[model samples]
Target: MNIEELASILRNNYTNADKGNKVSAIHAFGVQYANEIKENNYLATEIIKKSGLNESYSTELSKGIKLYDYMKNMSTDVENDTEHELLSKLPWCEIAAIAMYKNDKNYKYTPTEVKNLPLVVLAKKIKKAESPSIGTELRECSNDMTTDYHRKTRNLFIRENDLYYLSENGIKYVEENFSYMISDDIDMPLNQILYGPPGTGKTYFLGKIKNQIMEYNKKVFAKKQSVKENIMDLSWSEIIALGMYKANKTNSYKPNELYKLEYIKEYIDDKKENGGATPECSLRSDLMRNSIKCDALSESGKTGNDYFEYEISKKVYKLSQNGIDMVENALSKYINPSDKKEINEDDFCKFITFHQSYSYEDFIIGIRPDTDYDGGLKFKEKRGIFKIICDDALNNPDYKYLITIDEINRGNISKIFGELITLIEANKRWGNEEQQKLTLPTGGTLCVPNNLYIVGTMNTADKSLALLDVALRRRFEFVPKYPVYDIDGIYYVDFLKKLNETILLKKKKADYLIGHAYFMDKKKQPKLQDILNKKVIPLLMEYFNGDKGCVAEILKAADANIVFKDTFHLEVI
Candidate 1:
């Protein structure tokens, strides 16, 4: 490939390589921008700048690099030709693309290579973006969330960075309207709507983006539920899954399984990208540490278990120590209204447990208020206030609870989120409700939290089914779900993404593949083939066998690929 060819390829795929909002990748990748430069121009300039030369020079360098990389890594040797001379002029090798040719071609260079070109380019960049720290946070909510995967995928918006994972179209929308999108009132407590026709893969793409963010360098939370194979087995499947989870999951745990896997995944992923080990590191066996032990692993199977109650007892001891401190300092701090006492231990522990296992319902509506704050305030009168709800409890500092309602529109929004109409905003929270008493048609009283973030999802089709009680709408920030594809390395995440695409294209029925829970798995994700074999084919029967698709109808949909003589043997096209 010559310079023009190379620049053409880069330009064509630049947007595709983006896999995300072009603006975000440009910013994160350090694309240079001036006041007059638009997002595309800005990115173009950055690519040109990074090529170690000007735009024109960069184009030539990129082409030469592409050609050199493609040929240098070829199985057959490149004789001394213009190619060799061009190699010197070429910029740094597209090391990833060359590796792809080597692998896909099985080291047998042919007339044409670049079979694994996409994988190589993506993996290379992904390696750079993979980090333990969350650099930025972007909020996105989507509609058409019939499937859980759709919602979970959007949930990945909060995974990390300002990069939100949405479908390509969603990304384009943001790219087109990048300026107005960046707003201070992201959490305006308003119900933002994203409306459009069906079959756009709106939800599917959103999930893919979200999954990427969630798994970004954090240890996957191996909750008790994920260990379906029995934690004891630790099969190749489970071990690999655990390794990935550890590598991608957030680093919150003191001794997480993912931390152990981080070095391994990083080392292995690097080797694959760079082709064998570089000078600095080698893929080693010692990378496997015993931090994730079967004996130490809790019954839940994801995380290490507490042993001899020592870990448990250690926490208990801390509590006791804190209690002593609180008791010793209580009278001086608690009695005096103006005392400058810091939050004691008792208050700290309570805050830690807030919103740990909260659900969609908890966010839209307030928790049932407590009937016990006795500073001459009656329980019924203080029902609208959060302080009254925790009135019986000590006056301890609390974490502002945030409830992220994934696909907030999917449920019976009005019924599911009742009475919260009056108390969803931060200002109108706790003591902000002007109404002393607000009751719902369902006879439920609505209370709002002062420190609550009711992040929600709204699909346009479903948006008709209103969420965010008019009161709740006024108090929340509604960020649109933007789809991002360019996460650097991942080629196909949220395998159901394709299925969701298929569902969108077909628009005639449900897509079993894109389940919301699929995106929530903190660890190993089943492949598309696996889903086809397991869930896709089986659940699809609900469609084929249901009244809509009697025996003959299934045959047509199967396109002769599926022989549905009976249930299990049903073929897949």
Candidate 2:
């Protein structure tokens, strides 16, 4: 029986048993399935030992059973009784307050009704009060809470003396908002290629990896944006508060008090007027979007708030004097006059891939015609994606940008990359001591940044790695992806293994064999006959170049009743 069914039976049988007998039965069962329990969950072993039960049955009912075991143990503790009892009877307002307290941002503004009250005191009031309308209080409090500076900043409208109020609407708002954090995980290889035989899901795997890369970038950006500058700037109490919030997100733990101060709650009235639009943010947004479109960035969409400041920093480094003035005018709307300063756009750039016919001019700094403000055409030195992204990374030092090349091998690496190929080396990366800054054809120097990562996808089934540029080959790390086997309860995987063994022994090669992914179906099991006729037989026919007899032999070995026809098709008998 499956674990769920087994668990249900155990629960039902023990529901009405004597407490002492139930504990005894649990211990007995644990001892009975000790080996299987040990293999399944490590946590279950600890729970079983602590509960005075045999370790064997822990694995079978860990999810449902261990939770009850934990509660029973906790309730027996004398010291936790008062806090636990109060926690069990908390009103919804106190519960909401406890949840909101975990976030540090919520401490920026307290409700006017509770303005002078300490967090603990307010929580007690919430717990003791009857028919408490926390939402109505918050609405009344908001009218007197906002300051002039709060009105100016769109993201911080509800801030008073810096302690945010908790209400039903506030809770919903925080829940809806996506948490941004810069990824702490940077375990990716400097350069790696995903390569495998035909239809082995190599390309599909590349897309998945790309998503992870984006997510990493998003997380880092999110966490970084959580507080001003770095999280190191937060005080000890604030750091502790943030940690509690993260723990709550993971464990779904409720507060012992009616309210807690371990989280942050931001009150964003989305309909609240977000101040007058500053021309700078709007112009910069337009410029970034236009830049992405002009360079033909694939899948370019609206960027998040975390990307806003960084994108503007890049634009400053790339645009001319006339462009800088326009940006300064826009910047004037949001930033204080004293804080406004010129930024160099000389190095930052977004990358775009040239599908075909890319040359030095397209890949590097080249003269391009552009219309002047007066509608007159003029020639200007246009920088490429490599120079731009690298420039931005050098300036920020913290932010990382990725330039992905789909079907990287299809491009003429030597012609497109030019002198940059040597610079692509790990040692030659921008921050390295031995970094090479080469003078371009236009008499300008360029360097690739250490923070910038280059990601690309390659299909070995279409072309051999031997066809790749030797220099490029040596620079990148190639990860081989062969056909997979050992899919649990998947007979098709075993059949493919047998077929591959035959191919490797007879044809003396592995690449010609079938990939296990071709038979994968997690949602609904596919028919063996359908898999062969539509997917398997056709692939085999192509691999053997219509050698029907050879295909038939391989099929028979795998116990397939499909027949190869003169039409170069497969049909199940």
Candidate 3:
């Protein structure tokens, strides 16, 4: 019903109920209100505002309403009568924390564990559970309600009395991570297209995915014997030194604490007085070899033994139990390192750009001219990049592979993909019953493999997303990458914001706005005048189709240098 009616029911219920039942009555009201709103935050907020509840009680009730809605609509099977009853009995904060972890693909808490554990103990268990990714450790703080700068900066949860709750920033973080887009399906597709204006970092994002794939491949091929050798080469003193470093760095005595590879190598170099003389790659390889072994043991449940106990998260690793104990014993004596570097390895990713001339023959398979016997030209069957990657992925099922197509919308999709478009659907991949293959003109059959993922970057500035081919649209998940104004160290943030606003107001489309990359420099910060003169002004001129006055007006509104006389001029010089 309406907010007023819902608010009146809630107010009356709490007022009439006994003190012991009042809290339960409030929670029940929250559930009822959430059902009525169907997870609409505005309606819930309105109802809470109209209820005349105290600030603290209203905030708690609001969280309960959101938690109820999230749990009810989540992918997990929580619709059964028994599960529903159990959920209704649990505290809202506890359920929120559990629901958060459950939604993450990394965490694997069982249904039995969820039902049996108390909130405080469950929080501890979740902390103890090893997260596969680095820089994702749950941070704990004292109950004194002090400001935690790190947690505040990272938008991570705050722990008080062994229980976790979302901070103000953490709430936004949770919503972004947990909420599904309207077009999103229950199962997120392996094929995704990141579409946005040029320079919005779509390619940059794909680069990150490529690195992750390479890391995955490294882990898949890691040798246990090599790892054992690396660890065995280190003396007991050195091993204890590394372990103590990890413990002090992470503030964790856990068996599988993660540390960065470069940090460990630097510590070793400093300890040896090498004056940074060691080859960087050799040090990195040695560190990775050992860490990969630790990861293997951790995954196989062989950690916490006499030989070793540790694991790698990305390029970071935790030391063994023996190391942690020794470090704990000498906690007062060890010194922490100051410098840290992120790890990067050899490339295994395939990159291609799609254009008007790109075709199915270029993407799948085609016959190419080759020298035959007697020096006569003859056609030979040649496999395309897509087919090659698919074959490789099929052969190497244990490792992940990625194919990135830049400027995907620039090509004629139907002409490029042809019948193979149907083969890319999630169900039509190599292993499924619905898997289908197409016979190429060259006489071989092809099917996209499940282990191979396709990521494409589409520039909206080149073409509107609405005009994309429907067949291609159905197969790939489209993620919108928009311009970011709040990036640190970027010049002219306010000007970019205003310029985009003006463009949107004039053109009625966001696709034509300038992207943040124009103002960014990888090696050094770009001069604003140079950007305005060489990049921004020309782009604006192109966007306005040489209508200098219109461009001048837009620039004026954004507080940029503009001259409007008989001829419009950008006063960058």
lDDT of each: 0.33, 0.50, 0.59
Best to worst by lDDT, what's the order? Answer: 3, 2, 1
Q: Which lDDT tens digits does candidate 3 get at residues 128-217?
A: 433211112333211113444343234335543223344554454334323421112223358999988767878767766765566445
> Which 10-residue span in candidate 1 carries the lowest summed lDDT?
217-226
On TM-score, who's better, 1 or 3? Answer: 3
Q: What TM-score against the true fold does each predicted structure earn?
A: 0.31, 0.49, 0.48
For model 3, state the Cα shift of residue 332 in Å: 50
Off by over 4 Å in 2: 1-183, 228-396, 442-445, 487-491
Assess candidate 1 and give its lDDT.
0.33
RMSD in order of candidates? 23.1, 19.2, 17.2
Prediction 2 global C-alpha lDDT = 0.50
**Residue 158, candidate 1: C-alpha displacement in angstroms:** 39
